[model samples]
Target: MSDTKSAVGYTRLSQTSDASIPDQKREIRNLADREGFALLNIYDDGQRSSGFDAERPEYLEMQAELETGEVDVLVVRDRDRLSRDKRERSMFYYDLDEWDVELWTTTDGRVEFTDDESWLIEMIRNYMDDVTKRREIQKAKKKVQERVDNGYWQGRPPFGFRLDSDKRYLEPDPGKFDTALTVLQMRENGATWSEIEDETGVSAGTISRILDNEERYLSHVE
Candidate 1:
């Protein structure tokens, strides 16, 4: 119980850290020792920008340790002390929640699963995490809806159309688009989905597949 390798402490900053490693290190080591954690490692990134997505090697390394069960808990001053970006911070919290790793923040000291007050804390955490996820989903849905209204290609184009050099618009491929028109007219003529596929020399499956794609009808001229 007097050992010092049981948990890892991760500290970060979005811009530049006004805090120092020696300072944060002192606090974490003291906290862990007080709680009887062995104090595995203290991961720090002094001047790293959080703007670089997935570029924090130290953070990723800490996550790897968590995955391999190398630590009993992860301590931070607060979630923002981990990362200001919501997605990245949520990523760590989500993985910890799944792995059942004790997440502690001195801002709200000593969060633990066995604590009597944990249930209420956990309920609030769940609600907060849910709100974060819902906001992300709603943002994605809005982007897609906007794209559809503008007739911009939000997804890959059908076999006949290819994405433009900029990957923005879908441009008609002469062979594929003409063939598509043939298949479309055939469908309009009461030809079966399979028949149109066979007659057009485009696979019956491919023909049928294109018809089922929402972009075929929904993607518009922007």
Candidate 2:
């Protein structure tokens, strides 16, 4: 059997301008080769946010591999590629310890968890990343709310309404307004969600939103 250690790479991209997945992969592969590790696979979470709550399919898959205890090393371009949330990163570090997997990064080289000083440095880094992510989220929400305050629609219009000529406000769609009205009437007449869905082809979820925000939909038609 070959003496080379087995390694697997992971990459994640949250934005278009961030380091490309290909670039991260190349960096991980180069690092693995230079360190005499035999790279077994490279997992990617394309366009997936590093938020703690975000459901990353590839990240989960990589974790499952780690649980098998066959992977000797986990490679990434940087620690942030693993997670931006400090709490989440700490939990992951614990799991890596349990699985006996070494984490190698192109920027930081091998991560050493052997000392309090090293742990402090990692804690500081994770804290900074979490702050930056939260600020970006706040900025994005502010921009979206500003647009809504300016009488502009923030996202896709509801089922029965379309954006007006300028695409700034919601207007009743002539083709679907009657259907919307029918759905509301049916629900008010004690029609079940499944019955309405069967009659109008509008999903129960969409029908719920339409009923919940009935005033907003009615405002356009009135």
Candidate 3:
């Protein structure tokens, strides 16, 4: 058997706007080659949000493989690529400790788990990553809110509305106006949200919003 250590690379791009996965993979592969590690495979979570509650199939697969003792080391472009959440990072570190697996990163080199100093450094890194991610999220939300306040619709248009010529303000969808009117009529006639949903094919929550914003819908009518 070869003396080379077996390793698997993990790459994650938290958002579509984030850096490309290929770049991360290339860096990890280069590190592995330079370190004389036999890169067994690469697990990529492309364009998947790394929110605490988000599910990452590729990360889970990598964890499963780690449990099998086949992978001696886990490679990532950086610690944040593994996780930015402190709780998640702690849990992953515990697993690595339990499995006797080493973690190597291109940015920080090999993560030394044997010393308190190393652990403290890793904790500080995780905290910094968390702060940076939270700030970015706040900035994004503020921008979205500002757009909405400026009468620019974000994401998809509502059921009975479509983007206007400039693709900013929402205008009533001509084809769906009748359906919207019918929904309003049904609600005013004492129809339950569920009943209206079944009859009109619009969701109950959306029906509620439509009814709540009834004046806006009616304003478009001649």
Per-candidate clashes, comma-separated:
3, 0, 0
What TM-score does candidate 3 reach?
0.70
Q: Following a full C-alpha superposition, what root-mean-square deviation does model 2 have from the true structure?
A: 4.3
Best by TM-score: 3
Residue-wise C-alpha lDDT for candidate 2, range 11-126, written one tens digit per residue: 98887867998999999999998999999999988775655654688889999999999989999998888988889888898899889999999988999988899888888888
Compare candidates 1 and 2 on TM-score and give the better one.
Answer: 2
Candidate 2 — which residues are off by over 4 angstroms?
156-222
* Poorly placed runs, candidate 3 (over 4 Å): 156-167, 170-222
* RMSD after CA superposition, every candidate: 11.9, 4.3, 4.9
lDDT of 1 at 220: 37
Residue 131 local lDDT, model 2 = 89
- Show pairs that collide, candidate 3: none
Ranking by TM-score: 3, 2, 1
**lDDT, each prediction:** 0.70, 0.88, 0.87
Candidate 3: Cα lDDT at 161: 88
